[model samples]
Target: MIDVHMDPQVLAGLQEVMEGEYPRLLDTFLHDSEERVKALRTARGDTQALRQIAHSFKGSSGNLGAVRLALLCQRLEMASAGDIGGLVDQIDREFAVVRAMYEGELRRVFVG
Candidate 1:
Protein backbone atom coordinates (compact mmCIF):
# COMPACT_ATOMS: atom_id res chain seq x y z
CA MET A 1 0.00 0.00 0.00
CA ILE A 2 2.05 2.88 -1.25
CA ASP A 3 0.81 6.27 -0.21
CA VAL A 4 0.56 8.72 -3.07
CA HIS A 5 1.97 11.29 -0.71
CA MET A 6 5.39 9.60 -0.64
CA ASP A 7 7.49 6.61 -1.68
CA PRO A 8 8.38 4.32 1.18
CA GLN A 9 11.18 2.70 -0.80
CA VAL A 10 12.82 6.02 -1.47
CA LEU A 11 12.51 6.96 2.16
CA ALA A 12 13.98 3.63 3.17
CA GLY A 13 16.84 4.03 0.74
CA LEU A 14 17.59 7.44 2.15
CA GLN A 15 17.55 6.04 5.65
CA GLU A 16 19.95 3.28 4.68
CA VAL A 17 22.21 5.48 2.59
CA MET A 18 22.33 8.35 5.03
CA GLU A 19 23.10 6.10 8.02
CA GLY A 20 23.15 8.21 11.17
CA GLU A 21 22.43 11.43 9.36
CA TYR A 22 19.01 10.35 8.11
CA PRO A 23 17.22 12.21 10.85
CA ARG A 24 19.14 15.38 10.21
CA LEU A 25 18.48 15.08 6.51
CA LEU A 26 14.75 14.84 7.09
CA ASP A 27 14.98 17.77 9.51
CA THR A 28 16.78 19.91 6.95
CA PHE A 29 14.41 19.00 4.15
CA LEU A 30 11.44 19.85 6.33
CA HIS A 31 12.89 23.21 7.33
CA ASP A 32 13.93 24.15 3.82
CA SER A 33 10.60 23.00 2.45
CA GLU A 34 8.67 25.13 4.91
CA GLU A 35 10.45 28.20 3.59
CA ARG A 36 9.83 27.19 0.00
CA VAL A 37 6.14 26.64 0.67
CA LYS A 38 5.95 30.04 2.35
CA ALA A 39 7.75 31.58 -0.62
CA LEU A 40 5.16 30.09 -2.93
CA ARG A 41 2.49 31.89 -0.92
CA THR A 42 4.31 35.20 -1.00
CA ALA A 43 5.18 34.86 -4.67
CA ARG A 44 1.74 33.85 -5.80
CA GLY A 45 0.41 35.61 -8.90
CA ASP A 46 3.94 36.14 -10.18
CA THR A 47 4.50 33.49 -12.82
CA GLN A 48 8.26 33.85 -12.92
CA ALA A 49 8.74 33.67 -9.16
CA LEU A 50 6.25 30.83 -8.82
CA ARG A 51 8.05 28.78 -11.44
CA GLN A 52 11.40 29.31 -9.75
CA ILE A 53 10.12 28.41 -6.32
CA ALA A 54 8.20 25.44 -7.61
CA HIS A 55 11.19 24.20 -9.57
CA SER A 56 13.46 24.13 -6.53
CA PHE A 57 10.75 22.77 -4.30
CA LYS A 58 10.05 20.01 -6.80
CA GLY A 59 13.66 18.90 -6.76
CA SER A 60 13.87 18.80 -2.99
CA SER A 61 10.52 17.09 -2.62
CA GLY A 62 11.42 14.48 -5.18
CA ASN A 63 14.74 13.86 -3.48
CA LEU A 64 12.90 13.29 -0.24
CA GLY A 65 10.32 10.93 -1.78
CA ALA A 66 7.46 13.40 -1.54
CA VAL A 67 5.90 11.90 -4.65
CA ARG A 68 2.62 13.73 -4.75
CA LEU A 69 3.89 17.07 -3.56
CA ALA A 70 6.72 16.92 -6.07
CA LEU A 71 4.18 16.40 -8.82
CA LEU A 72 2.19 19.38 -7.56
CA CYS A 73 5.29 21.52 -7.64
CA GLN A 74 6.07 20.26 -11.12
CA ARG A 75 2.66 21.46 -12.20
CA LEU A 76 3.36 24.80 -10.58
CA GLU A 77 6.72 25.00 -12.31
CA MET A 78 4.99 24.68 -15.63
CA ALA A 79 2.01 26.85 -14.77
CA SER A 80 0.98 29.42 -17.40
CA ALA A 81 -0.65 32.13 -15.35
CA GLY A 82 -3.73 30.02 -14.86
CA ASP A 83 -5.13 29.52 -11.37
CA ILE A 84 -1.90 30.41 -9.67
CA GLY A 85 -3.72 31.00 -6.44
CA GLY A 86 -5.34 27.59 -6.48
CA LEU A 87 -2.07 25.87 -7.28
CA VAL A 88 -0.29 27.68 -4.48
CA ASP A 89 -3.01 26.65 -2.12
CA GLN A 90 -2.57 23.05 -3.20
CA ILE A 91 1.16 23.21 -2.70
CA ASP A 92 0.67 24.81 0.70
CA ARG A 93 -1.66 22.05 1.80
CA GLU A 94 0.56 19.29 0.49
CA PHE A 95 3.60 20.69 2.27
CA ALA A 96 1.77 20.75 5.53
CA VAL A 97 0.98 17.09 5.14
CA VAL A 98 4.52 16.19 4.16
CA ARG A 99 5.95 18.10 7.10
CA ALA A 100 3.69 16.32 9.52
CA MET A 101 4.56 12.93 8.07
CA TYR A 102 8.26 13.53 8.34
CA GLU A 103 7.95 14.97 11.81
CA GLY A 104 6.07 11.90 12.87
CA GLU A 105 8.73 9.64 11.41
CA LEU A 106 11.37 11.56 13.32
CA ARG A 107 9.57 11.22 16.60
CA ARG A 108 8.68 7.55 16.25
CA VAL A 109 11.97 6.26 14.88
CA PHE A 110 14.46 8.67 16.35
CA VAL A 111 12.90 9.38 19.68
CA GLY A 112 11.64 5.91 20.46
Candidate 2:
Protein backbone atom coordinates (compact mmCIF):
# COMPACT_ATOMS: atom_id res chain seq x y z
CA MET A 1 0.00 0.00 0.00
CA ILE A 2 1.02 3.59 -0.51
CA ASP A 3 2.11 5.54 2.55
CA VAL A 4 -0.28 8.01 4.06
CA HIS A 5 -0.02 11.40 2.34
CA MET A 6 0.36 13.54 5.50
CA ASP A 7 2.20 11.92 8.39
CA PRO A 8 -0.15 11.79 11.36
CA GLN A 9 2.71 11.84 13.85
CA VAL A 10 4.10 15.02 12.32
CA LEU A 11 0.72 16.68 12.35
CA ALA A 12 0.15 15.70 15.95
CA GLY A 13 3.52 17.07 16.92
CA LEU A 14 2.80 20.32 15.11
CA GLN A 15 -0.56 20.57 16.80
CA GLU A 16 1.04 20.05 20.18
CA VAL A 17 3.45 22.91 19.63
CA MET A 18 1.30 25.24 17.55
CA GLU A 19 -1.99 24.73 19.40
CA GLY A 20 -4.67 27.03 17.95
CA GLU A 21 -2.25 28.31 15.29
CA TYR A 22 -2.13 24.91 13.62
CA PRO A 23 -5.00 25.71 11.29
CA ARG A 24 -3.39 28.96 10.28
CA LEU A 25 -0.17 27.15 9.61
CA LEU A 26 -1.97 24.73 7.32
CA ASP A 27 -3.70 27.60 5.56
CA THR A 28 -0.41 29.39 4.97
CA PHE A 29 1.18 26.27 3.55
CA LEU A 30 -1.74 25.70 1.21
CA HIS A 31 -1.69 29.26 -0.02
CA ASP A 32 2.06 29.39 -0.51
CA SER A 33 2.14 25.98 -2.19
CA GLU A 34 -0.53 27.09 -4.60
CA GLU A 35 1.59 30.08 -5.57
CA ARG A 36 4.70 27.97 -5.96
CA VAL A 37 2.88 25.52 -8.21
CA LYS A 38 1.57 28.37 -10.30
CA ALA A 39 5.07 29.83 -10.64
CA LEU A 40 6.45 26.44 -11.58
CA ARG A 41 3.83 26.03 -14.29
CA THR A 42 4.66 29.39 -15.75
CA ALA A 43 8.41 29.20 -15.37
CA ARG A 44 8.74 27.49 -18.77
CA GLY A 45 12.35 27.37 -19.96
CA ASP A 46 13.76 29.03 -16.87
CA THR A 47 15.52 26.04 -15.35
CA GLN A 48 17.30 28.07 -12.70
CA ALA A 49 14.06 29.60 -11.48
CA LEU A 50 12.33 26.23 -11.54
CA ARG A 51 15.10 24.62 -9.53
CA GLN A 52 15.03 27.39 -6.95
CA ILE A 53 11.28 27.21 -6.53
CA ALA A 54 11.24 23.42 -6.35
CA HIS A 55 14.04 23.39 -3.80
CA SER A 56 12.23 25.75 -1.46
CA PHE A 57 8.87 24.07 -1.97
CA LYS A 58 10.29 20.62 -1.29
CA GLY A 59 11.51 21.68 2.15
CA SER A 60 8.16 23.14 3.19
CA SER A 61 6.20 20.12 1.93
CA GLY A 62 8.49 17.76 3.76
CA ASN A 63 8.09 19.79 6.93
CA LEU A 64 4.32 19.56 6.54
CA GLY A 65 4.58 15.76 6.14
CA ALA A 66 3.63 15.64 2.47
CA VAL A 67 6.33 13.16 1.60
CA ARG A 68 5.02 12.34 -1.86
CA LEU A 69 4.72 15.98 -2.72
CA ALA A 70 8.25 16.60 -1.53
CA LEU A 71 9.47 13.71 -3.66
CA LEU A 72 7.69 15.14 -6.65
CA CYS A 73 9.32 18.48 -5.97
CA GLN A 74 12.69 16.75 -5.77
CA ARG A 75 12.07 15.16 -9.16
CA LEU A 76 11.11 18.46 -10.64
CA GLU A 77 14.18 20.07 -9.15
CA MET A 78 16.43 17.42 -10.66
CA ALA A 79 14.62 17.43 -13.96
CA SER A 80 15.19 21.14 -14.21
CA ALA A 81 18.75 20.24 -15.07
CA GLY A 82 17.57 18.58 -18.27
CA ASP A 83 14.06 17.94 -19.57
CA ILE A 84 11.84 19.88 -17.24
CA GLY A 85 9.10 20.02 -19.86
CA GLY A 86 8.49 16.28 -19.70
CA LEU A 87 7.97 16.41 -15.94
CA VAL A 88 5.53 19.29 -15.89
CA ASP A 89 2.38 17.24 -16.45
CA GLN A 90 3.34 14.68 -13.87
CA ILE A 91 4.15 17.40 -11.37
CA ASP A 92 0.81 19.08 -12.03
CA ARG A 93 -1.10 15.85 -11.45
CA GLU A 94 0.75 14.98 -8.27
CA PHE A 95 0.22 18.49 -6.95
CA ALA A 96 -3.48 18.22 -7.63
CA VAL A 97 -3.61 15.15 -5.42
CA VAL A 98 -1.62 16.92 -2.74
CA ARG A 99 -3.86 19.96 -2.90
CA ALA A 100 -7.00 17.89 -2.53
CA MET A 101 -5.60 15.96 0.40
CA TYR A 102 -4.52 19.13 2.19
CA GLU A 103 -7.87 20.81 1.57
CA GLY A 104 -9.64 17.82 3.05
CA GLU A 105 -7.30 17.93 6.02
CA LEU A 106 -7.94 21.62 6.53
CA ARG A 107 -11.70 21.11 6.56
CA ARG A 108 -11.39 18.23 8.97
CA VAL A 109 -9.27 20.22 11.37
CA PHE A 110 -10.96 23.59 11.12
CA VAL A 111 -14.58 22.81 10.26
CA GLY A 112 -15.30 19.39 11.60
- List the candidates' TM-scores in order: 0.93, 0.87
User: Residues 5-36, candidate 2, lDDT per residue (tens digit)?
Assistant: 67778877887899889989988998998898
lDDT (Cα, 0-100) at 59 in candidate 2: 97
* Lowest summed lDDT window (length 10), candidate 2: 1-10
Candidate 2 residue 67 Cα shift, in angstroms, is: 0.5
Stretches of candidate 2 off by over 4 Å are 1-4, 80-82
Query: Cα miss at 77, model 2 (Å)?
Result: 1.6
Relative to the true structure, how large is the alpha-carbon lDDT of every model?
A: 0.88, 0.81
Best by lDDT: 1
* Predicted candidate 1 versus true structure: per-residue lDDT over 1-112, tens digit per residue: 2258978899899999998999999999999998998888888868999999999999999999999899998988887787778889988988888888999988866776
